[model samples]
Target: MDMMMVIYNGLLSDEYIKGQATGRIKFYEYPPTGDISGPYIVIDPLGPPQSADYGDNIPIKDDYLYQIDVWTKNRLVTKELSKRVQKVMRSIGFGYFAGGVDEYDKDTGIYRDARRYRGKAYTEEFEI
Candidate 1:
Protein backbone atom coordinates (compact mmCIF):
# COMPACT_ATOMS: atom_id res chain seq x y z
CA MET A 1 0.00 0.00 0.00
CA ASP A 2 1.06 3.62 -0.52
CA MET A 3 2.35 4.83 2.88
CA MET A 4 2.21 8.56 2.18
CA MET A 5 -1.35 8.22 0.93
CA VAL A 6 -2.16 6.44 4.15
CA ILE A 7 -0.65 9.26 6.20
CA TYR A 8 -2.40 11.89 4.09
CA ASN A 9 -5.71 10.10 4.45
CA GLY A 10 -5.16 9.67 8.16
CA LEU A 11 -4.63 13.40 8.55
CA LEU A 12 -7.55 14.19 6.28
CA SER A 13 -9.81 11.86 8.21
CA ASP A 14 -9.39 13.79 11.45
CA GLU A 15 -12.13 16.26 12.32
CA TYR A 16 -9.74 18.99 13.43
CA ILE A 17 -7.65 18.61 10.29
CA LYS A 18 -10.75 18.49 8.13
CA GLY A 19 -12.17 21.68 9.55
CA GLN A 20 -8.90 23.55 9.86
CA ALA A 21 -7.24 22.77 6.54
CA THR A 22 -9.36 20.82 4.16
CA GLY A 23 -7.59 20.09 0.87
CA ARG A 24 -4.56 21.96 2.17
CA ILE A 25 -2.32 18.95 2.57
CA LYS A 26 0.39 18.19 0.04
CA PHE A 27 2.43 15.00 -0.24
CA TYR A 28 5.56 15.95 -2.09
CA GLU A 29 9.12 17.21 -1.73
CA TYR A 30 8.14 20.79 -2.60
CA PRO A 31 4.98 22.72 -1.96
CA PRO A 32 2.99 23.49 -5.11
CA THR A 33 3.73 26.77 -6.88
CA GLY A 34 1.23 29.22 -5.36
CA ASP A 35 -1.26 26.37 -5.45
CA ILE A 36 -3.84 27.32 -2.86
CA SER A 37 -0.97 29.14 -1.12
CA GLY A 38 0.39 28.90 2.44
CA PRO A 39 -1.33 27.94 5.69
CA TYR A 40 -0.99 24.44 4.24
CA ILE A 41 0.90 21.26 5.11
CA VAL A 42 3.42 19.02 3.38
CA ILE A 43 4.08 15.36 4.15
CA ASP A 44 7.37 13.81 3.06
CA PRO A 45 8.69 10.31 3.54
CA LEU A 46 12.02 10.22 5.34
CA GLY A 47 12.86 6.64 4.44
CA PRO A 48 11.55 3.57 2.73
CA PRO A 49 9.35 1.21 4.72
CA GLN A 50 11.45 -1.54 6.19
CA SER A 51 10.52 -4.99 7.41
CA ALA A 52 10.16 -4.92 11.17
CA ASP A 53 8.75 -8.31 11.97
CA TYR A 54 8.81 -11.68 10.28
CA GLY A 55 7.27 -15.07 10.75
CA ASP A 56 8.09 -18.20 8.85
CA ASN A 57 10.29 -16.32 6.46
CA ILE A 58 7.62 -13.77 5.66
CA PRO A 59 7.47 -10.12 6.55
CA ILE A 60 4.53 -9.46 8.82
CA LYS A 61 5.01 -5.84 9.86
CA ASP A 62 6.79 -2.84 8.41
CA ASP A 63 8.24 0.35 9.85
CA TYR A 64 7.64 3.80 8.41
CA LEU A 65 9.06 7.26 8.98
CA TYR A 66 7.66 10.53 7.71
CA GLN A 67 8.11 14.24 8.27
CA ILE A 68 5.11 16.55 8.34
CA ASP A 69 5.56 20.28 7.93
CA VAL A 70 2.91 22.69 9.10
CA TRP A 71 2.95 26.06 7.38
CA THR A 72 0.93 28.99 8.58
CA LYS A 73 0.99 32.75 8.85
CA ASN A 74 2.24 32.93 12.43
CA ARG A 75 3.79 31.04 15.30
CA LEU A 76 0.61 30.59 17.29
CA VAL A 77 -1.22 28.99 14.41
CA THR A 78 1.74 26.79 13.62
CA LYS A 79 2.02 25.61 17.23
CA GLU A 80 -1.70 24.91 17.51
CA LEU A 81 -1.76 23.02 14.25
CA SER A 82 1.37 21.14 15.19
CA LYS A 83 -0.21 19.95 18.41
CA ARG A 84 -3.35 18.83 16.61
CA VAL A 85 -1.24 17.07 14.01
CA GLN A 86 0.78 15.21 16.65
CA LYS A 87 -2.39 14.12 18.39
CA VAL A 88 -4.00 12.95 15.18
CA MET A 89 -0.92 11.02 14.14
CA ARG A 90 -0.65 9.31 17.53
CA SER A 91 -4.30 8.39 17.31
CA ILE A 92 -3.48 6.68 14.04
CA GLY A 93 -0.70 4.62 15.71
CA PHE A 94 2.23 6.85 14.85
CA GLY A 95 4.65 8.04 17.51
CA TYR A 96 6.54 11.31 17.63
CA PHE A 97 10.16 10.97 16.59
CA ALA A 98 11.17 14.63 16.35
CA GLY A 99 9.43 17.98 16.15
CA GLY A 100 9.00 21.65 16.91
CA VAL A 101 11.68 22.98 14.57
CA ASP A 102 9.88 26.23 13.93
CA GLU A 103 11.22 28.67 11.39
CA TYR A 104 10.18 31.67 9.40
CA ASP A 105 10.35 31.82 5.63
CA LYS A 106 11.69 35.29 4.83
CA ASP A 107 10.50 35.09 1.25
CA THR A 108 6.93 34.01 1.96
CA GLY A 109 6.59 35.32 5.50
CA ILE A 110 5.22 31.96 6.57
CA TYR A 111 6.02 30.01 9.71
CA ARG A 112 6.98 26.39 9.32
CA ASP A 113 6.74 23.77 12.08
CA ALA A 114 8.40 20.53 11.16
CA ARG A 115 7.65 17.23 12.89
CA ARG A 116 8.46 13.61 12.31
CA TYR A 117 6.68 10.39 13.19
CA ARG A 118 7.51 6.71 13.09
CA GLY A 119 5.14 3.76 13.01
CA LYS A 120 5.41 0.01 12.73
CA ALA A 121 2.35 -1.97 11.79
CA TYR A 122 1.03 -4.82 9.81
CA THR A 123 0.47 -3.81 6.22
CA GLU A 124 -3.24 -4.63 6.44
CA GLU A 125 -3.72 -2.53 9.58
CA PHE A 126 -3.00 0.59 7.55
CA GLU A 127 -5.91 0.03 5.18
CA ILE A 128 -8.00 3.15 4.90
Candidate 2:
Protein backbone atom coordinates (compact mmCIF):
# COMPACT_ATOMS: atom_id res chain seq x y z
CA MET A 1 0.00 0.00 0.00
CA ASP A 2 1.03 3.56 -0.62
CA MET A 3 2.53 5.26 2.41
CA MET A 4 0.06 8.09 2.49
CA MET A 5 -2.82 5.71 2.07
CA VAL A 6 -1.56 3.65 4.94
CA ILE A 7 -1.31 6.66 7.19
CA TYR A 8 -4.70 7.96 6.08
CA ASN A 9 -6.33 4.62 6.75
CA GLY A 10 -4.70 4.41 10.13
CA LEU A 11 -5.97 7.85 11.06
CA LEU A 12 -9.43 7.00 9.81
CA SER A 13 -9.47 3.85 11.87
CA ASP A 14 -8.43 5.70 15.02
CA GLU A 15 -11.39 6.07 17.34
CA TYR A 16 -10.42 9.47 18.71
CA ILE A 17 -9.67 10.98 15.34
CA LYS A 18 -12.67 9.39 13.70
CA GLY A 19 -15.00 10.58 16.42
CA GLN A 20 -13.66 14.12 16.39
CA ALA A 21 -13.12 14.65 12.68
CA THR A 22 -14.90 12.00 10.76
CA GLY A 23 -14.31 12.26 7.02
CA ARG A 24 -12.37 15.44 7.62
CA ILE A 25 -8.84 14.20 7.07
CA LYS A 26 -7.76 15.04 3.57
CA PHE A 27 -4.80 13.97 1.47
CA TYR A 28 -2.58 16.42 -0.41
CA GLU A 29 -5.09 19.26 -0.23
CA TYR A 30 -8.57 20.13 0.85
CA PRO A 31 -11.55 20.35 -1.49
CA PRO A 32 -11.93 23.49 -3.56
CA THR A 33 -15.53 24.11 -2.64
CA GLY A 34 -17.00 22.50 0.41
CA ASP A 35 -17.70 22.91 4.07
CA ILE A 36 -14.07 23.49 4.99
CA SER A 37 -14.53 24.08 8.67
CA GLY A 38 -11.80 24.44 11.23
CA PRO A 39 -10.18 21.56 13.11
CA TYR A 40 -9.42 19.61 9.94
CA ILE A 41 -6.16 17.96 8.95
CA VAL A 42 -4.19 17.96 5.72
CA ILE A 43 -1.60 15.36 4.86
CA ASP A 44 1.23 16.35 2.55
CA PRO A 45 4.34 14.61 1.36
CA LEU A 46 7.57 16.21 2.39
CA GLY A 47 9.47 14.62 -0.48
CA PRO A 48 10.24 11.33 -2.16
CA PRO A 49 11.09 8.38 -0.01
CA GLN A 50 14.74 7.48 0.36
CA SER A 51 16.40 4.13 0.75
CA ALA A 52 17.14 3.50 4.37
CA ASP A 53 19.68 0.85 3.54
CA TYR A 54 20.75 -1.38 0.68
CA GLY A 55 22.06 -4.92 0.31
CA ASP A 56 23.43 -6.52 -2.83
CA ASN A 57 22.36 -3.45 -4.81
CA ILE A 58 18.81 -3.74 -3.54
CA PRO A 59 16.91 -1.54 -1.19
CA ILE A 60 16.04 -3.46 1.94
CA LYS A 61 14.04 -0.72 3.56
CA ASP A 62 12.59 2.65 2.61
CA ASP A 63 12.01 5.69 4.74
CA TYR A 64 9.15 8.05 4.04
CA LEU A 65 8.76 11.58 5.39
CA TYR A 66 5.42 13.26 5.71
CA GLN A 67 3.86 16.28 7.35
CA ILE A 68 0.46 16.31 9.03
CA ASP A 69 -0.96 19.76 9.48
CA VAL A 70 -3.73 20.48 11.97
CA TRP A 71 -5.61 23.65 11.31
CA THR A 72 -8.11 25.35 13.54
CA LYS A 73 -9.43 28.78 14.35
CA ASN A 74 -9.08 28.31 18.07
CA ARG A 75 -5.67 27.96 19.69
CA LEU A 76 -6.79 25.32 22.16
CA VAL A 77 -8.49 23.28 19.47
CA THR A 78 -5.39 23.47 17.35
CA LYS A 79 -3.25 22.06 20.14
CA GLU A 80 -5.70 19.29 20.87
CA LEU A 81 -5.97 18.28 17.24
CA SER A 82 -2.20 18.25 16.86
CA LYS A 83 -1.86 15.98 19.86
CA ARG A 84 -4.43 13.60 18.44
CA VAL A 85 -2.56 13.45 15.15
CA GLN A 86 0.70 12.75 16.97
CA LYS A 87 -0.81 9.90 18.91
CA VAL A 88 -2.28 8.35 15.78
CA MET A 89 1.02 8.58 13.91
CA ARG A 90 2.98 7.11 16.78
CA SER A 91 0.57 4.23 17.01
CA ILE A 92 1.29 3.56 13.34
CA GLY A 93 5.01 3.17 14.12
CA PHE A 94 6.22 6.52 12.90
CA GLY A 95 9.22 8.24 14.48
CA TYR A 96 8.28 11.65 15.69
CA PHE A 97 10.41 14.72 15.00
CA ALA A 98 10.37 18.32 16.04
CA GLY A 99 7.77 20.24 14.09
CA GLY A 100 7.26 23.95 13.76
CA VAL A 101 4.26 26.20 14.19
CA ASP A 102 2.97 28.74 11.75
CA GLU A 103 1.89 32.28 12.43
CA TYR A 104 -1.78 32.96 12.72
CA ASP A 105 -3.38 33.83 9.41
CA LYS A 106 -5.08 37.12 9.74
CA ASP A 107 -7.14 36.74 6.61
CA THR A 108 -8.47 33.26 7.27
CA GLY A 109 -8.12 33.29 11.05
CA ILE A 110 -6.58 29.85 10.81
CA TYR A 111 -3.78 28.58 12.98
CA ARG A 112 -1.72 25.69 11.62
CA ASP A 113 0.49 23.34 13.58
CA ALA A 114 2.53 20.88 11.55
CA ARG A 115 4.14 17.67 12.68
CA ARG A 116 6.73 15.61 10.85
CA TYR A 117 7.11 11.85 11.05
CA ARG A 118 9.30 9.20 9.49
CA GLY A 119 7.98 5.74 8.76
CA LYS A 120 9.99 2.77 7.67
CA ALA A 121 8.69 -0.11 5.63
CA TYR A 122 10.31 -3.04 3.93
CA THR A 123 10.54 -3.44 0.14
CA GLU A 124 11.49 -6.30 -2.08
CA GLU A 125 12.54 -6.61 -5.71
CA PHE A 126 14.49 -9.09 -7.76
CA GLU A 127 16.78 -8.43 -10.66
CA ILE A 128 15.93 -10.17 -13.90
Candidate 3:
Protein backbone atom coordinates (compact mmCIF):
# COMPACT_ATOMS: atom_id res chain seq x y z
CA MET A 1 0.00 0.00 0.00
CA ASP A 2 2.94 2.26 -0.52
CA MET A 3 2.65 2.89 -4.21
CA MET A 4 3.66 6.46 -4.84
CA MET A 5 4.70 8.27 -7.99
CA VAL A 6 6.07 11.65 -8.99
CA ILE A 7 7.88 12.88 -12.08
CA TYR A 8 8.10 16.46 -13.22
CA ASN A 9 10.67 17.73 -15.66
CA GLY A 10 8.76 19.69 -18.19
CA LEU A 11 11.87 21.64 -19.08
CA LEU A 12 12.03 22.71 -15.43
CA SER A 13 9.43 25.39 -16.12
CA ASP A 14 11.23 28.12 -14.21
CA GLU A 15 10.27 26.40 -10.94
CA TYR A 16 6.77 27.76 -10.78
CA ILE A 17 5.79 29.18 -7.41
CA LYS A 18 2.63 31.21 -7.85
CA GLY A 19 0.35 29.90 -5.14
CA GLN A 20 1.93 26.50 -5.52
CA ALA A 21 0.82 26.03 -9.06
CA THR A 22 -0.09 22.40 -9.75
CA GLY A 23 -1.23 22.35 -13.32
CA ARG A 24 0.25 18.89 -13.57
CA ILE A 25 3.05 18.58 -11.02
CA LYS A 26 2.41 14.99 -9.91
CA PHE A 27 4.26 14.85 -6.59
CA TYR A 28 6.68 17.47 -5.33
CA GLU A 29 4.99 17.61 -1.95
CA TYR A 30 7.61 20.11 -0.73
CA PRO A 31 10.86 18.87 0.81
CA PRO A 32 13.80 21.20 0.26
CA THR A 33 14.77 22.81 3.55
CA GLY A 34 18.07 24.74 3.53
CA ASP A 35 21.87 24.05 3.40
CA ILE A 36 22.07 22.50 -0.05
CA SER A 37 22.10 18.76 -0.72
CA GLY A 38 21.52 16.86 -3.96
CA PRO A 39 18.80 16.30 -6.55
CA TYR A 40 15.73 18.47 -6.18
CA ILE A 41 16.58 21.43 -8.37
CA VAL A 42 15.15 24.96 -8.13
CA ILE A 43 17.75 26.86 -6.14
CA ASP A 44 20.09 29.01 -8.15
CA PRO A 45 21.05 32.03 -6.04
CA LEU A 46 22.97 32.80 -9.21
CA GLY A 47 23.67 29.31 -10.52
CA PRO A 48 27.30 28.18 -11.05
CA PRO A 49 29.01 26.39 -8.17
CA GLN A 50 28.22 22.66 -8.08
CA SER A 51 31.46 21.04 -7.01
CA ALA A 52 34.36 22.83 -5.32
CA ASP A 53 32.71 22.05 -1.97
CA TYR A 54 29.00 21.94 -2.74
CA GLY A 55 28.71 25.07 -4.79
CA ASP A 56 25.54 25.25 -6.82
CA ASN A 57 23.99 22.84 -4.36
CA ILE A 58 20.51 23.66 -3.12
CA PRO A 59 18.26 20.72 -2.46
CA ILE A 60 18.17 19.61 1.11
CA LYS A 61 14.49 19.48 0.45
CA ASP A 62 12.05 20.23 -2.30
CA ASP A 63 10.53 16.88 -1.93
CA TYR A 64 12.45 13.94 -3.38
CA LEU A 65 12.93 11.11 -0.96
CA TYR A 66 12.29 8.02 -2.98
CA GLN A 67 14.26 5.27 -1.23
CA ILE A 68 14.64 1.72 -2.38
CA ASP A 69 17.92 0.73 -3.92
CA VAL A 70 17.84 -3.02 -3.85
CA TRP A 71 20.10 -3.78 -6.78
CA THR A 72 20.71 -7.26 -8.15
CA LYS A 73 21.22 -8.36 -11.70
CA ASN A 74 22.28 -11.70 -10.36
CA ARG A 75 24.15 -11.14 -7.16
CA LEU A 76 24.12 -14.88 -6.52
CA VAL A 77 20.58 -14.63 -7.79
CA THR A 78 19.75 -12.63 -4.68
CA LYS A 79 19.67 -15.74 -2.58
CA GLU A 80 17.12 -17.08 -4.99
CA LEU A 81 15.13 -13.90 -4.85
CA SER A 82 15.20 -14.00 -1.11
CA LYS A 83 13.89 -17.52 -1.07
CA ARG A 84 11.25 -16.63 -3.56
CA VAL A 85 10.12 -13.68 -1.51
CA GLN A 86 9.95 -15.65 1.64
CA LYS A 87 8.32 -18.44 -0.31
CA VAL A 88 5.50 -16.21 -1.38
CA MET A 89 5.36 -14.98 2.17
CA ARG A 90 4.84 -18.47 3.40
CA SER A 91 2.14 -19.52 0.98
CA ILE A 92 -0.05 -16.55 1.97
CA GLY A 93 0.45 -16.09 5.67
CA PHE A 94 2.85 -13.21 5.34
CA GLY A 95 5.04 -13.18 8.42
CA TYR A 96 7.22 -10.19 7.93
CA PHE A 97 6.64 -6.47 7.35
CA ALA A 98 6.38 -6.15 11.09
CA GLY A 99 6.59 -2.38 10.80
CA GLY A 100 3.13 -3.05 12.10
CA VAL A 101 2.62 -6.69 12.92
CA ASP A 102 2.08 -10.15 11.48
CA GLU A 103 -0.17 -9.02 8.67
CA TYR A 104 -1.46 -10.31 5.37
CA ASP A 105 -5.01 -10.78 4.33
CA LYS A 106 -5.81 -11.24 0.72
CA ASP A 107 -9.43 -10.62 1.63
CA THR A 108 -9.22 -12.70 4.79
CA GLY A 109 -6.52 -15.15 5.79
CA ILE A 110 -3.53 -14.04 7.76
CA TYR A 111 -3.58 -11.23 10.20
CA ARG A 112 -2.01 -11.54 13.59
CA ASP A 113 -3.51 -8.25 14.68
CA ALA A 114 -1.30 -5.67 13.13
CA ARG A 115 -2.78 -3.56 15.90
CA ARG A 116 -6.05 -5.04 14.78
CA TYR A 117 -6.12 -3.12 11.56
CA ARG A 118 -9.35 -1.23 12.11
CA GLY A 119 -10.94 -3.32 14.75
CA LYS A 120 -14.00 -5.48 14.44
CA ALA A 121 -11.28 -7.94 15.23
CA TYR A 122 -10.01 -7.51 11.69
CA THR A 123 -10.35 -10.44 9.31
CA GLU A 124 -7.92 -13.11 8.02
CA GLU A 125 -7.39 -14.82 11.35
CA PHE A 126 -6.31 -13.39 14.68
CA GLU A 127 -8.79 -14.38 17.25
CA ILE A 128 -6.71 -14.17 20.34
Most accurate candidate by TM-score: 1
Backbone clash total for model 2 is: 0
Error of 1 at 24 (Å): 1.6
Count clashing residue pairs per candidate. Answer: 0, 0, 9
Q: What's the CA error at residue 58 for candidate 2, in Å?
A: 1.6
Query: What is the descending lDDT order?
Result: 1, 2, 3
Per-candidate TM-score against the hidden true structure: 0.81, 0.81, 0.17
Highest lDDT model number: 1
In the range 14-102, model 2's lDDT, one tens digit per residue, is 67677767777888885333334746888888899898777888787778889998777788877877787888888877877767566
Q: Write the per-residue lDDT of candidate 1 for residues 54-96, one digit (tens) a residue.
A: 7777778889998998887777878888888888889778999
Displacement of residue 90 (Cα, Å) in model 1 is 0.5
lDDT of 3 by residue, 45-116 (tens): 112212221214532212112211111223333333233333333343333332332223344222222111
TM-score of candidate 2 to 2 decimals: 0.81
Q: How many clashes does the backbone of model 3 have?
A: 9
Model 3 lDDT at residue 43:
13
Q: How well does candidate 1 match the true structure, expressed as C-alpha RMSD?
A: 3.0
